[model samples]
Target chain A: MERLWNTHIIEVGFDKIVEFFYRMSEVADKLRQEGLYFRYGPERLPEIIRIPERGTLRVKYGFPIFQKYGVCMDVTNVEQALIAEEAGATSVMVLDKLPYDVRSSGGIARMASINRIREVMDNVTIPVMAKVRIGHYMEARILEALGIDMIDESEVLTPADEERHINKWLFKVPFVNGARNLGEALRRIYEGASMIRTKGEAGTGNVAEAVKHMRTLMNEVMVLTFMSPEDRMKKAREYGVPYELVDLVSHLRRLPVVNFAAGGIATPADAALMMWLGADGVFVGSGIFKSQDPHIRAEAIVLATSMWWSPDIVLEAQSMIDEAKSMMGIDIRKLKPEELLQVRGV
Target chain B: MKVGILAYQGGVDEHRYMVVEACKELSISCEVVNVVEKHSASNIDALIIPGGESTTILKLMKRFGVDEVIRKSIENGLPVMGTCAGAILLAKRVKDLKTGRVLQGTLETLDMLVIRNFYGRQRESFEIDLDIQVLGEKPFRGIFIRSPAIVEVGQGVEVMARYGESYVLVRQGKVFASTFHPELSGDTRLHKYFIEFVKR
Candidate 1:
């Protein structure tokens, strides 16, 4: 009797399934007439299949939704974090050692101490971010447990796993990853990175790599926008990212998430240049703490980033800083390929 | 109609897109401007303060000498909507959620007391469907990112919506403020309501 009832239900459900598909196609046609089909295209149906709960989706997208633009200062200690916050920095990246120090002391670099990060969080009202080694899922877990605002699966620190990065989708707190070009950026996004930053050479105080990465990413995005659907799919395959993400980028003409310039940005002019080149914001690693006067320099960088469109305000910001006090920059050409930080994480 | 968004930092582009889209839906011809300076602030029909770090926006506004101009403009009956950090800026008093200390240098345009980061940190940020009656029967999704909470409202202020115990949306005369980001939700009802408010 139970078997007969189950078979009867299946037979009846089959026609309902067919009817459902028929109605869905009809709805799709109407949406196409309204020019909204591409936004909810069939190719994006897989994303719907993998959708998390509504609450989780909200937390996942909230990082970029409320991301504070302008200057994101990298600070090594509690005092530096406090100063950065007071100087109007949108956020501060907590580090166990400044990039320059990490370069000077050659050893295995790991996440910052929990106590120090806690102290910084206690001292400042602004958002606090911390870094974890590339592919270091354990460190990411630890940071998430500590209730850090954001995590950077950073290449500046040593890579914990050379083959794979931490699956960002598993974590609730948003993760930011570094990318040198559009392909790398889309790949990181596919891995659930909520934000992307240029993988410029860190601890060098040189903006050339930062400029090159930004230009390369922007130019690739522009090229993608002009590509045919078939070519975009081919590009997506080449990028090893989802086709829908590539298609979305082609339509939107920009990264799906906020893209900030990071690594070796120093001085007010450099920050402004990155902004002019289309960075959503900037991250100054060793620039502030290594400068002659960190407090004034931090404020100046914030000013330049906020008012990059106005040359007079940028000039005033530049005048506030003494050029002689700037960090001694390293020539990128002098560094061996093995010593370069940007080449670490895929 | 011309609308200006405080464009120094944060989600300026998001707000601009929402306003433009709302205007198009309403069939209202609109000019959207970035209110970066005094001249831009004073010439706009309505002003929007986009969500960011309130301290950062306040500091830059004061630095560029536009803070006072914006305050006076709103005082003179300029319809304004403040979201998230923008809402914090319009409060009469702002207190740190953790320290319970008062934050100084806000615009003090609205008669309310707000607690900054009242919902906790970014990890605590959320999105939920809210029943905003002023927006009609359809529920509006509220995206609260490190959002503040209105702890107290003055006699003149009307509470329009709430999340649990605290008020999330409030309006007094021509000034409207919401502790959550309506721009990020991809909904234009609140923007349409603001446009109508400006029209009136």
Candidate 2:
């Protein structure tokens, strides 16, 4: 009764590159078995395909690590993780230093200790994610080896590379990258990120930056909906991503991967605001543990996030904790341009 | 017509968005039923169980006493649709993947047995196009994310759609269940179908 509908089809060109790699590796294995070297001369080598500096690519694997409306809390130890789990957090993001402490303490930030990560993973039934320095493939590999559920190539950590970021397509574990704009999101997607988080000036507790970033990304997507195919192709060329991916964004009217809001989210209201703005969820870092009532705040954020559509539920969540006992708000404007975590990658 | 989406837990937003889109297309009224305790069969023309963690949803459903209410309402001819984890809760029997332990608390509205995560874990999740007869010649892209699979179907249950012989979408009178997420597919045909089903 129906003709073929082509409007919803999505073509991810990077998938072809991944398939090519698989083929090359298989061919190399065959050659090695015959005691031969299969080598392509520079002239015969496959032309290097250029990816747009900031275009979204199709994600290969999607492990539902976090449930919809679930909160992924940032924890530094097993106890906080367990607390988060008990409070209804779907997942926990293990970190060596909470963003607020990182800003105040000002030092070389790095990945959390493997031993601590293992302890947290051992205790929590929920998924455990950890952070690695941006562009640090080795750290990502180590996290993967330790069997981390997900890895955040975070801007919160001191970036390891200046020119390039970690190539996530090579890993078995999924990666979550932070973005402040559509181009940055697209570029990270091209790099094979399974999840995207708004890098909203971490440790601020203001929620303004998170709102701005989310609106900016969504607005950019909204603009794409009205553009002509030729204009979209032109935009794709400008963004440096495959036209198919751009087209997919146009059709879906949202990012293909799970998009979360992070960086400055603090209260139940803050979490609810992000959900209303179309974030898949919210990541509370210094927000919960930094507050006076970690347990109540954690539980409240989870409830507020899940029942975001209800203002009465949000009000109840807000009433559960005191705002004065929460983490001191930092004016994002006061932070120098170099101190901003969102500006690290791209 | 007023459609109620069960909003106790997981993937609630996606369902709300898709259902709202479907309503707009059909020009019908819609509301998200968060307080399951307060929801009555008379007020809701139909209900949608959104995807999420089945265990958590089951526990909450029990706590709020929504489980008994929903099960009874469905028995009384209340139209309902369950997707992903929702499908597992709607099945007659649910078994744990590794422990082989049988867990129950499902609505048992659909006359079938489902194995949680039968296809595989989250990393193994995938999307495939399927030829659903009722939806016409256009194939529906089913998004399977750690979804359950129907292992057995009882009498009176009609298998409406499948992905390569695997039972993914099934219907039993007023009850509908799908192993994949049609809401996230950015296609409202399934939602439209449900709304049309409600109108009838």
Instruction: Give the TM-score of each candidate.
Output: 0.90, 0.71
Instruction: Show where candidate 1 strays beyond 4 Å.
Output: A1-55
Please give, for residues A1-346, the per-residue lDDT of candidate 2 as tens digits.
1111221122322233334334534565567569895332101122222221111121133344226567889999988987887787878899888999999999889999999998887666556799999999999989887877689999999999977888786675778899998888988877768788999989889899999998998888888989999999998998877786787777667776778889899999899888888787789999999999999899889878776767886898899989898999799889888888888997
Whole-model lDDT, candidate 1? 0.82
Q: Provide per-model DockQ scores.
A: 0.37, 0.14
Model 2, TM vs. native: 0.71
Clashing pairs in 2: A2-B137, A52-A240, A55-A186, A55-A187, A56-A186
lDDT of 1 by residue, B80-163 (tens): 999998999899999988857787988898999999989888777766778899888777877778889998999999999998
Write one digit per residue (lDDT tens) for candidate 1, span A1-346.
Answer: 0110110111111112223323434565677779876322111112121121222444545555455457889998888987998899999999988898898898989999999999998878888999999999999989988888889999999999987887786687888999999998988877778789998999889999999998899889889878999999999999997686787677667776778888788899999888888788899999999888999999999999888778888899999999999999889999888889988876
The segments of candidate 2 whose C-alpha lies over 4 angstroms from its true place after superposition are A1-66, A118-123, A144-147, A223-238, A242-253, A333-336, B1-3, B8-37, B40-42, B55-68, B91-121, B126-144, B148-200
- Predicted model with the maximum DockQ: 1
Q: Per-residue error at A84 for model 1, in Å?
A: 0.6
Would you list the clashing residue pairs of candidate 1? Answer: none
